[model samples]
Target: MKTITTAVAALFALSTAVAADEVCMNASEMQSSLIDWYGERPVEGPSANNTRLWVSDATGSWTLVRTTDEGKACVAAQGRNWNASMDASDVLSEIAENTES
Candidate 1:
């Protein structure tokens, strides 16, 4: 009845949040030989290089993604390390942790 419906809705919401929060904190986890990574070079406006488009990986199991063009970023796909590197740590999570502290 009404209680069951509410419980189902709550479960759905909780599951989604948990899935998103499983963000891979390591940059190396974002790479896979199955898919390709691009620089996204744009001729006009801010360089597309500032933005990245990481697409499908083998079996497409988990996640990691980062973008610097503002707005926000969500973990897109995760795999063994395979791209440019920088200081380690989940970029978005680190940002959130820093801001909260």
Candidate 2:
């Protein structure tokens, strides 16, 4: 019984590690998604004429800027919370890919 429990524990740990590793998006996918989402906007600061969409994930964070003030205003109105340690860009990219495909 003790041996079975130990085996189960080890299996659980391995599964958890695998899940973490597969959490989501690769770098290129992330960059692509951001580019698609931002459209024609220049990726930089959140200016009055540019809307900034910021995202975070397990690895890091990224921002997508929109060229038109109207777009910026729309995102600002939505009030998304962009405060995660991981790479949210990757997560979003993964989600987009999954949903689209």
Candidate 3:
């Protein structure tokens, strides 16, 4: 009985963990398909880095939408993994270093 309970719990945990991974919704094969899904978001000032982040007012959910100088836009990520409150240089560096072009 104990063995069966443990097995069931393990399976449940594995399933939940697998479902938590987030995939980019606005995938780009060619450059043109990368238009902003949420439309034009506001910015702080002029000459910003073509980056628009949409943070949900209710859920604290967030999505980063960045447009390259080539006019290609894509959702970089969606999670509680960002904020304008602090510097995320280390996290950003680790991600940049690990990602493959």
Candidate 4:
């Protein structure tokens, strides 16, 4: 979970960094589109800052979305091959440790 939180944080930063090309809209619309278009559903979060992780079981795809207090939402990041079993904290720690060096 810590790893996911770190990733969510990074994604949020990345979104702000690349705001010019970001696809943003009303939060509800983004939610509906993720489900309708990619079969993704909220699997985790609405974290301390309203970030959420959405994943598609059928497609093995995942997305990170960050919503603002005013109800705007943006796709922070997205990728394929999501595996719940692989979401171990230690694995994430190792990845982060390696990244720092």
Candidate 5:
């Protein structure tokens, strides 16, 4: 789990350094896409400007999304092996550490 988290964090950090291919849509459409296509549902929300975490227990897949002031939702990060028992703050701290390195 820690390895997956670190890998995800590293990927996310590298993604930020490069030009991201962000897909944006109206909040409704984004929600439907996550549910229908990925079977992910919102489990966390409104952090740092309307950010939310969606997870699919069936597949252990997860996605982080953020909504803009215009109400458009965009995918920020996505990966697998999402453990509901894990603390979000811990994952975020891992991300911060990975980014710093």
Candidate 6:
């Protein structure tokens, strides 16, 4: 019984590790996609005045794109971890605060 319990625990640990790794990989891929889309683009200033945020899960990959003012704010506030799980509006608020300062 002890051995069986130990084996089950080991299996559970392995499963958890695998799931974490997958999540990390997905996050990294999403970051890469966002960077590619916004490379060399300023996230603030006049260029960002009309920006918008775009979220997509196409290609089995989650991606966030910022286009104009609000989009620029979200990216600036949240950095590369921006995704579907994030509250983009909250990020915009942070950006607003930052800009006011």
The per-candidate count of clashes, in order, stands at 1, 8, 0, 0, 0, 5
Task: List model 5 lDDT by residue over 1-101, tens digit each.
Answer: 78666655644544332117887899999999999999988876667657787878787777778799998998766767566565565555454455453
Q: Write model 3 residue lDDT over 1-101, tens digit each, in one string.
A: 46444433332232211123533333253222222432222322212555454443333334445566665555554454333342233333333343325
TM-score of 5: 0.70
Q: Estimate the TM-score of every prediction.
A: 0.23, 0.22, 0.33, 0.65, 0.70, 0.28
Task: Itemize residue pairs with steric clashes in candidate 5.
Answer: none
Clashes of 2: 8
How high is the CA lDDT of each candidate model?
0.32, 0.35, 0.37, 0.64, 0.69, 0.34
Q: lDDT by residue for model 2 over 20-72, one digit each (tens)?
A: 23323443444466557632222235445343444433222334333442322
Worst 10 residues of 1 by lDDT: 39-48
* Arranged by lDDT, best first: 5, 4, 3, 2, 6, 1
Which model, 5 or 6, shows the larger TM-score?
A: 5
Q: Which stretches of candidate 2 lie over 4 Å from their true place?
A: 1-32, 35-47, 69-101
- Candidate 2: global Cα-lDDT? 0.35
Which regions in candidate 3 have their CA more than 4 angstroms from the true location? 1-48, 80-101
Instruction: Show pairs that collide, candidate 6.
Output: 50-68, 51-67, 51-68, 51-69, 52-67
Q: What are the candidates' C-alpha RMSDs?
A: 13.5, 16.2, 12.6, 6.6, 4.1, 15.7
List candidate 5 segments past 4 Å from native: 1-19, 92-101
**Candidate of highest lDDT:** 5
Error of model 4, residue 20, in angstroms: 3.7
